[model samples]
Target: MTLFSREVELLQLEQDPDPGVVVFAFDLETNGMTTRCDILQIGVKGFNWSTDEGFVQEFNQYVTPTNEIPQHSSRVHHLARDEDGDLVKETDTPGNHEKLETLPIKAALTNMWEWLLKDNPPVLLVGFNNSRFDNHIILHHSKICCEPDLMDRVRSRVHFTDLRTVLSQRGEQGNLESHYNSCDGPPLELHDAISDCTAICWVLNGKAVSYDELRGRAVSLESVLQKKNKSSHPLLIGKLVTPKVAEKIGFITRENYLKFSEEELIRFLKTKGVTKISITLCVKKWRAVSYEADF
Candidate 1:
């Protein structure tokens, strides 16, 4: 093939565009992992792939759950249905039905939908654990908050991107885990809406973690933990799936990662799933960490 042809082929494999585009980073903390789960918080981060603008905001509210949030859930998330709970500050946002500062779920959802639709966006929705959980909650809450048709319109018009699944697929052992428990940081402390939003924002805009640094840490940890081998997982997990394309194996979209030539495949394998932790600890991190942030 000619040089131009070769350049085009390589470009086809890249996920992020050069400039002038943005991605909407999304996350939701829920009461459970099932369809019956209640969404306690919605975290949104907007990242510009082009201009590199990123910002996060939380629309947290107390919901009268159809089912109770389990005690373990309360322990992990502290989302008890307390009449006096600080999930929302009365002065920050007040409404009888657990709305954020001034906007109820429906209104907050509208802001999202409009932001997405009106932006003339070459944008997509992103969530850490969004595929199975965040998307469901967004669909559910949108329906409850607005008409079914409106929700359908949002679903049809807006593209949903799941960062967790992609990160997981690229995992050394097929799972990328967030290390929020140890000395490392994942913005887990606030346990409140705003903090998680910040974390998600940092992640999508490519500000959250780095592989070069993590690899250095992994090498050090191996020496301290007395392990013979350092975990190889962090070196594999990356931004595998792209909303710009169709995903095949969770994060590695069918459009390209699966179609990579042997050369590109090697680069992708080395670069795709290389997260910030070792494979051994990555799995534990995934299992131990509770899913936070709502899409």
Candidate 2:
């Protein structure tokens, strides 16, 4: 739904008004971070910006993959091949595939956006590591699962926040593996989606924050990308728009764009059919993700 004063008010009630009107925090477990990866499940929590405290909502589903769920994925989530498992599993078996109706998850997500709108409030999407991966998965999978176009359409005005960015912005490094070591408490296991997500949430337990990578910010997208490159060995494609930029642009799966040649960039840019000037302005934002740029 669109963000308006009244909508924002109702959202605030749901999220306890952490800062804006409503902020919904969620966590997701997937086979991987690609359109190729199956969306195993999703867990969501909505909070009010004004109050900081919040209520919870959740949606979890298993997908009928067009591809196989890798063994590596199975190890991370600790998802069992059978029921009563500690984590959710990706099954290609006949019976597991027939578990749900047209949409494996009927009540959860399809009706969630509407339920949040019932209050007519502006909602912020918060997640342990979303705003990038999870959000992309939800959008891509919704399409894959043949859900309403309205689901992805809501991106225009959904308030979004992610603890991962906060950690990165705070200059924290290392995978989730490192976070566990630095903490005074126990280490967080990585492949377990909900557990890993909950650990990230612990990082933002007391604060409510929001950010937009596209909008105006103190860090130019280029500069932020460079720092990311300098931190690593600089993979072959890393020289292009840097992994950081790629991730920010919502293609975290691609190592980097540097490996792509100018011809590739041009061919990519050319692939788009001619469109109106107004539409061009919006599509132009993707110029970085859609093409080549490097030091």
What TM-score, over all chains together, does every model reach?
A: 0.49, 0.50
* Worst 10-residue lDDT window, candidate 1: 215-224
lDDT tens digits by residue: candidate 2, 110-221: 5555555555544555555555466656655544443455543443234445555666776765555455445533455655544554444444333333323211112211
* Model 1 C-alpha lDDT per residue in residues 1-295, reported as the tens digit of each score: 2212222322333354434344556666666776546666666665544443355333444333545656677555555554543343222233333323334557767666666667343335665555545665676567578766655455334555555544454451221224232224443544445465555555544533322222111111111112222243222233222323223223333322322333344444445443222112234545532222111
Runs off by more than 4 Å, candidate 1: 1-15, 50-68, 83-104, 120-123, 172-194, 205-295
In candidate 2, where is summed lDDT lowest over 10 consecutive residues? 274-283
Clashing pairs counted in every model: 20, 19
Local lDDT at 120 for model 2: 51
Model 2 ranges with Cα > 4 A deviation: 1-22, 47-67, 80-108, 111-118, 128-132, 144-149, 176-190, 206-295
> Once model 1 is optimally superposed onto the true structure by TM-score, how far is the C-alpha of residue 204 displaced, in angstroms?
3.8
